[model samples]
Target: MSNNGGNGGGSVLATFEAGTQGWSGTSLAGGPWSTTAWSSQGSRSLQGDITMSAGSQHYLLKSGSTNFTGYTKLRATVKGASWGSYGSGLGVKLFVKHGSSYAWKDSGWVTISAGGLANLTLDLAGVNLADIKEYGIQFIGASNASGTTAVYVDNVVLGN
Candidate 1:
């Protein structure tokens, strides 16, 4: 076994395997997150849903844990569903807690046309990883349109 240790107690923060632990929202008409094998949530919207495929939706893996003050990274694999180009764009947001609220610190957007995989990595060198208790992944609809779309998210791993 590989020995991966770090300042966060040398423990794995969170790991999301495909067809395994993840979150989804209400089954929309041909919704990608609804049909896939991700975990299910009840929240659905006309502009896509933000479901946690593995961990808690409101709180990420490192939430409430000691602030990660060392080298850290956030990685994930994502794909979008067919809702025309309306729901093909998705975004990931990183948040850090300030006082009693979480704030959006970083965000990355990806488009999945023709159904392919996109890998995303965010470096958390300067950000206060320790204060981050919650993070979010959101599916963005086509600009200037309002409707439901589907997306697939998997392989969310955080490490040092």
Candidate 2:
């Protein structure tokens, strides 16, 4: 999928093949989430696992200051396992930095089917791309699931 990491009309923003590439894993909502590396599309993939669980656990992979001006979309190849139910258990979202003081724009929500690999894209058409600081994935509605929920991320590329 994704033309093997090709962004169709734009240059690749990041591949994360160089060891996280300034991105870091965050256990949001104090969820028992941890990160590890595995193989994806013949390269290394970052895997986020909910090793433990709290009610409504949340987690994110975040980093900053990419200057993504002019880019209108973000593409990410991912796979999910467990993640509870689509509505009440495990859900995913894409967010972009907004304005000068580091606010966030909730770009869109991604649907994660249990144990499925998906190539998903998000629109960045309306945001102030000129002031973009960063972009990342956030897990939402993780309350009903146990520690078995996991998401693997790879080939996260930004494009026009």
Candidate 3:
């Protein structure tokens, strides 16, 4: 239940209302992003499962071009689990891909609590909206850890 204003105001991006229509994942030690549960706003939340017996490097990436032509910011509702028991929080990395060039604008880690929800915002200042080729979320951990974790997301919106 938020308003993302872009172009003139409020542009709708991937709602995941009908599955991850064009989304994909690349994981080294984790599962994929699946639309299995309806999260906030009564829509399916994108879920990511990570297991790191030695280390963790998982991804929930979206590619194949986007129409964020006039957006100024990106937002999402993010939550993490299995963190409290581990005594370490979870970090969700945000990747903003610049179109044809294939370069990326990366944000520092967004820390989320164990089973707690948080709102995240990544400023798209100086980013080429119309030329964006991909977007990604990376789940990472310190070296040689042993655990299984997860992050849940809903209402990913690009805004002004």
Candidate 4:
């Protein structure tokens, strides 16, 4: 992990410039994650195919000793193929692992239009970030629906 001292926040966690950077997705409807040229920060971004479903959780994880002790937020640049039904279920979250179980945090529903890159931020004010064995990005919501959709993620950072 490289620290960029980002926009008055903290440091760069993953930019997917080289590759998946150890990030992998689970419960994917479309998958085998790969890098794409569609990026908001660097040369490439991580891409995955996800099926939208009510009350479903799909995410990607990377293992590392990430210390978020002084960081108050997590930010990432994201792009989506289709945001089916614009319900309150469309948003992102964070999963941080300290022990065996992972502690989760939410970003609420963000207004991201299709075909454009959006900057999404999640609060880390109450998250336990010290001695983190793993960290991840979780996409939540898209309630009462089903089908595969594409999502791209890039320039992940932790800051205040």
Off by over 4 Å in 4: 1-6, 82-89, 99-101, 111-113
**lDDT tens readout by residue for model 3, 118-160:** 6667788878877888886766654444566666666677766
Model 1, residue 103: C-alpha shift (Å): 3.0
TM-score-best of 2 and 3: 3
Candidate 4: tens digits of C-alpha lDDT, residues 1-160: 5565355746888888788877888877765355664777657888877777787777777776667788887787777765445344346655566644565555655644445456778777666778667776677656654666677888888877
**Candidate 1 TM-score to native:** 0.52
Please, what is the TM-score per model?
A: 0.52, 0.73, 0.78, 0.76
When sorted by TM-score, best at the front, the candidate numbers are 3, 4, 2, 1
lDDT of 2 by residue, 26-53 (tens): 7632332223444455566666655434
For each candidate, C-alpha RMSD in Å?
Answer: 8.5, 4.3, 3.6, 3.1
C-alpha lDDT of all candidate models, in order: 0.41, 0.60, 0.64, 0.69
Give every collision pair in model 2. 56-143
Question: Residue 113 in model 1: shift from native, Å?
Answer: 2.7
Write the number of the candidate with greater TM-score, choosing between 1 and 4.
4
Clashes of each: 11, 1, 3, 2
lDDT of 1 by residue, 1-160 (tens): 1223232333333333222233333323432222333321222211223332222122222235345555477655455445443333333343334234564554455544524446666666666666765543544334433444345554444656
Report the Cα lDDT for residue 106, model 2: 63
